[model samples]
Target: MTKRSRRTHSAGLKAKVALAALKGEKTLAELAQQYDVHPSQITAWKQQLVEHAADLFGGGK
Candidate 1:
């Protein structure tokens, strides 16, 4: 039998998934299913977004 390779997602994809979760339109389980990732992973990405959201605009021009 052939071995299955581990799946990996990029930062952009994680950010997109996190944004979708933040929208509150779907449950975590649904998001996980849609993205084909673990719910905990999505939760971590969402938390990271929340923690750094201000940084995106906080930089002084």
Candidate 2:
């Protein structure tokens, strides 16, 4: 089996995946398959989104 190269995801893509996870419209496994990302990564992004969501409202400071 060939090892896959590491991939870098853009902020926009990360945000998109994170938002989808937050929506609860799909299971993590389903999202992972659709996005070609690991469920743990999606969970991490979702956590970051939830943690920093206030930053969008200028509450980051």
Candidate 3:
């Protein structure tokens, strides 16, 4: 039996992937394969980016 180890991604990497997703230039599956992350994770990151986009414009202090 083989066990999978947990992988940790840096904030910068997450942001990069999320931005790629936002660009809509590639499918989520393609992004996942290129980034070596799960599609679901990419989806979550995209959602987070969308939800927090206003924060970048002084919405949050």
Candidate 4:
């Protein structure tokens, strides 16, 4: 069996995936399959988005 190489995702894709996760329109497994990413990674991205969302509005101060 050939080993899979580690892939890097762009920031735009990460934001899109995280936004999709936050929409609650689909399950994590579905999102993972669609985006070719692990559900745990999606969860982490979603969490990161939620945690830092306030910073976008200058509310982090």
* Residue 21 in candidate 4, Cα distance off native in Å: 0.6
Q: State the TM-score for model 2.
A: 0.93
Q: What is the Cα-based lDDT of residue 26 in candidate 2?
A: 100
Q: What is the C-alpha lDDT profile of model 1 across 1-61, one tens digit per residue?
A: 9997898889899999999999999999999999899999999999999999888899833
List residue ranges in candidate 1 displaced over 4 A.
Answer: 1-4
Query: Candidate 3: where is the Cα deviation over 4 Å?
Result: 59-61
How big is the positional error of residue 4 in model 3, measured in Å on the Cα after superposition?
1.7
| Residue 32 local lDDT, model 3 | 99
- C-alpha lDDT of residue 22 in model 1: 99
- Model number with the top lDDT: 2
**Model 1 local distance difference test score:** 0.94
Question: Which scores better on TM-score, 2 or 3?
Answer: 2
TM-scores of the models, in the order given? 0.83, 0.93, 0.90, 0.90
Among residues 3 or more apart in sequence or in different chains, the pairs in candidate 1 whose N, CA or C atoms overlap within 3 Å are none
lDDT of 3 by residue, 1-61 (tens): 9997998999899999999999999999999999999999999999999999889997696
lDDT of each: 0.94, 0.98, 0.95, 0.95
- For candidate 3, the per-residue lDDT at 46 reads 94
Stretches > 4 Å off in candidate 4 = none
